[model samples]
Target: MQIAYLMNTYPVTSATFIRREIAALEAQGVSVRRFAVRPWDQQLVDDADRQEQTRTTYLLAPGGLRLVLLTMAESLRNPRGFWRAAKTAWTLYRNAGRGALVRHVAYLMEAVHLKRLANGCTHVHAHFSTNTAAVALLCARLGGPGYSFTAHGPDEFLDPGAASLGLKLQMARFAVAITEFARVQLALAGGMGIWPKLHVVRCGVDVTDLRPAPPPATDAPFVCVGRLCVQKAQEHIVAALADLHQTHPQARVILIGDGDTRPAITAAIARHGLGEHVELRGWADNAAVKDALSGARALLLPSFAEGLPIVIMEAHALGRPVISTYIAGIPELVDQQTGWLVPAGDVPALAAAMRACMDTPPEELASMGAMARARVEAAHDVTRNATDLKALFSRYV
Candidate 1:
């Protein structure tokens, strides 16, 4: 099957394991084409360059003031129609807007983009269930075969009046939710009655290739992997550092990934005088992250929401335990058995969990980590997960 892949981001270094998934699909005999939005990120350029394959790229014709205005007005409405109208308007916006003169201009440009794309893709699938999906839906309607998208957190779930619901239900052939929790949230919030259309395909890891966690060490407390975003709750993890230090003074947090919140997360760590104990190593590439995972005691992901986070699965795959918040599809992955689940945004509880984790015996943690690996092998492997997704795509075919 030929698939046209779409995404708001091709790669941001910290995200876009999506590239690897696409590569895997291609290796499995799927003819794949890519469509992405800009401003183009370097990480994407690197991956695309490394593959040495050229893809037809399209960018919105910049300077569409009228388009922005129309989308803004449409998005400000009530909880229900906001996303729908806004999405419809934004498609017009992306191509340039719905104004009388611009409509034909935008339509002509869209047609050109498609002609350049040279349609043979069976399904057009966007990574996130938002703007890119809207773009893909328009492409499908403009004579691409069918469309689908993978829905994950933050903006898609948090935006109340987002124009994603109906677009997801009626436009796309079938949508994939990273977790069942994400699917439920889409139904409850997106006003998509046809929630059954969602296929819960996890963001998976390279199952057999996962490097096992390093043998228990005396110094490292926990490893946190994620961008320094408020959604990640890095401050909450930093807040718990002091409480953790009183007992496991030798323990330190090795933070991976960086973003706008780095300064705030750093300041919080310092305010508590735990700077010596927290190491913000900025962004590490996937290989380096795996090395850290191999060496760390446990993985900590206290994010406020998610759609089956890949970090948790990586931790489990490598036989390293996880400490995460209970929200969205997180609970579906984490539990009393795999790892500890802390309350979302709770500083004290998070702090206590850290202390307890540090104090837990190495042997016990290893045992827990083993259980974590078992969970991934049983439920989150990408091969099995891909088959399920292919089945969903076939229904639309």
Candidate 2:
């Protein structure tokens, strides 16, 4: 089967799971074509990502005028399909407000481009229920292949109406939820009529490639891997580390990603006198992330919201425990045996968890790490999840 994968930005550091998903499908003898709405900035760091940029087609890379011309030519070729897509865009505009209307127009143009490029693909699957899915929905309306999308929550669920997620669900051949919590949220937002089409497919990790490394000899420093953004709550980690310093004077944190919050996080570290305690290592490639996890005491992510962070599974696959917030789909993966789950935004609670991890016996921590790895092997294996996804796509294809 041939599938076209649509993404707003390809090869983004934060969404490596998407790349893995595509690779897993191809491994199972499925042909996949990648399409990105816009070219990612020069910030592309990973070698794999650079290679992907060469292979994937970018819709807006040729500039706005070219897209406008393409849309016009496409409309001239198939006026009925163009009218159907334009009518859908107008409906989205009326419901989602003026700003969304402008965005949907851009999505409409991209949809036209996608329809032209998506040759021999049996289905179009988008990774998120955001702009890329918007384009996917319109592409289908403009006589493209049947489309489906995976909705990773926190953002889409935050304002489903604003994003017109319900309409997208109504139009899609199927909708995928990464977690049960996300499935429930999609049901609520999209209504029960769309429930039959919703399926729970957990985001997964390639455990074989991430075999457990020997734990660090000492639990002095921890590692946190994700974008340095507000939702990640890295600031809370900084605060917690400050509190831990009062007891564990040698406590340190290696932040493995970078974003808009870097300056603020740096300020927080300095303000809390954690200049030496918290080190922002900036963005690292996947191999570098695994290497960092190999040497770290545990993975720390105090996100206020999430859709079962793939990093948690990665940490588990690497035989490292995680200390993360208990919000969204996190509790399903993290537990008393695998790792600690504290309430989001609770600095005191997070600090206590950090202290407990630091104080735990090495043998006990190793046991927990073992259980963590076993959990991922059983539940979040990428190859297995890909098989499930392929089965789902086969039904429509």
The per-candidate count of clashes, in order, stands at 4, 0
Q: Give each model's whole-structure lDDT.
A: 0.70, 0.90
Which has the greatest lDDT? 2
Runs of candidate 1 with Cα error greater than 4 angstroms are 42-56, 60-118, 189-193
TM value for model 2: 0.98
Clashes of 2: 0
Worst 10 residues of 1 by lDDT: 107-116
lDDT of 2: 0.90
Q: Highest TM-score: give the candidate number.
A: 2
Candidate 2 lDDT tens digits, 208-241: 8999878666744799999889999999999998
